[model samples]
Target: MPYALYYWPTIQGRGEFVRLALEEAGVPYDDVARGPEPDGGVPAMLALIDGDSVPHPPFAPPFLRAGRLLIGQTATILLFLGDRHGLAPKTESGRLWVHQIQLTLADLVVEAHDTHHPIASSLYYEDQKPEAARRAESFRNERIPKFLGWCETVLERSGGPWLGGRRVTYADLSLFQAVEGLRFAFPKTMKRQERKSPRVVALRDAVAARPRIAAYLASERRIPFNQMGIFRHYPELDP
Candidate 1:
């Protein structure tokens, strides 16, 4: 049976992380929400969240329904897929480390999203422009370097072109998404910091060059980054 992935049809968001892992592994899966409604579109995704058909329900979108199992949360889903698809290390300690890195990346994702939605997700970016400006300043000047620097350190420690030493892992894919999103949302900031994180930038480029990933990226299956997604581009916030 094909794996069923449920996420918003428009934006990549957190689901992109899971999608990257599946694509990199050459795993076959259905992007449920993107299909027609009769098949499994937005309604089907909402049903999974609201319906009582399953014993376990996800609190949000970007959940995966695999056979009899329903899994939620981006990091948890990646951990499950990583182990199953060989996107993570075989050893327990190594798996845990990859999960740890994924969770940290998740944190960074939230922070990046919050830069544009600093006041509240409910409020429009225009309504909270002042607050967002303040938030973006700190994020651009301090947080970006801190997170990217840490990733560079990890790559240096691994002594690799990939995050999991010699092998590519879900963590590497997630980092690639992060770099892409950051570049879209804060091109100026990322361009300035890219010099400091050569290994991290190289890893992003390396992931992009992978055959499956490269194809996925070029294909229509991979959604383009837009303002509605976690990483939104606003000229003022980035400046």
Candidate 2:
């Protein structure tokens, strides 16, 4: 059966990472909140989350319901899907390496999210813009380069068109998502250093150009990035 992806309806947010892999692999799954059927929208997502159908419930968005398995956490869900599907490398070492990359990507994502809400996730950006600004500065000046540099090193060592050598793995797709999110949120930083991260940028572009991914990107199904969600682009944050 196709997986049921539970997440917010409007923002790409964390769900975009899962969406990228599913789209690239051309996997048939319902993006639960964004589905065309009326029974498959936000209400459906809420019901699933609120229901007692499963013993282990996901704590947050971007969870996947595949058969009897109910999985949460972006990295964990991706790792599970990557292994069950062909999106991960077959070898144990390769799979472990991909999981490592995915986990690191998850860390980068949380940091990116916190840049706009450094004080607290529950607080509004307006409520903590000053703290957010402070965090953004550090992120732009230090965290961004450090994370990107590690990814660059990974790419360099992998000798890849993809993170896992020749094949397109979940790590590569997640990396593309991360690069996309960062570029959206930190365009100025990205423009300044993207050339230095050639392989990472290339992977982003390649993921974008994949037939299904490209189509989804162009389609109405793909949600646009906004001020809310993990990667918010503030002009001041960039400059």
- Top-scoring candidate (TM-score): 1
lDDT by residue for model 1 over 1-239, one digit each (tens)? Answer: 46999999999999999999999989899999999988779998999889977789998979998888899999989988998899999998889888899999999999999999998999888999989999999999999999999999999998898877988999999999999999999999998999999999899999999999999999999999998999999999877
- lDDT at 77, model 1: 93
Model 1 — TM-score against the truth?
A: 0.98
Across 1-239, the per-residue lDDT of candidate 2 in tens digits comes to 38888889889899988888778778788877877557788877777668887588677787888888888888888888787779998999999989998999889999999999899888899999998889999999999999999998888888888888889998888888888888899998999879889988998888888888889999987888888878999888889
Candidate 1, superposed: residue stretches over 4 Å from native: none
**Global lDDT of each candidate:** 0.93, 0.86
Clashes of each: 0, 0
lDDT for 39 in candidate 2 is: 72
Where is model 1 poorest over a 10-residue stretch in terms of lDDT?
47-56
Give the local distance difference test score of model 1.
0.93
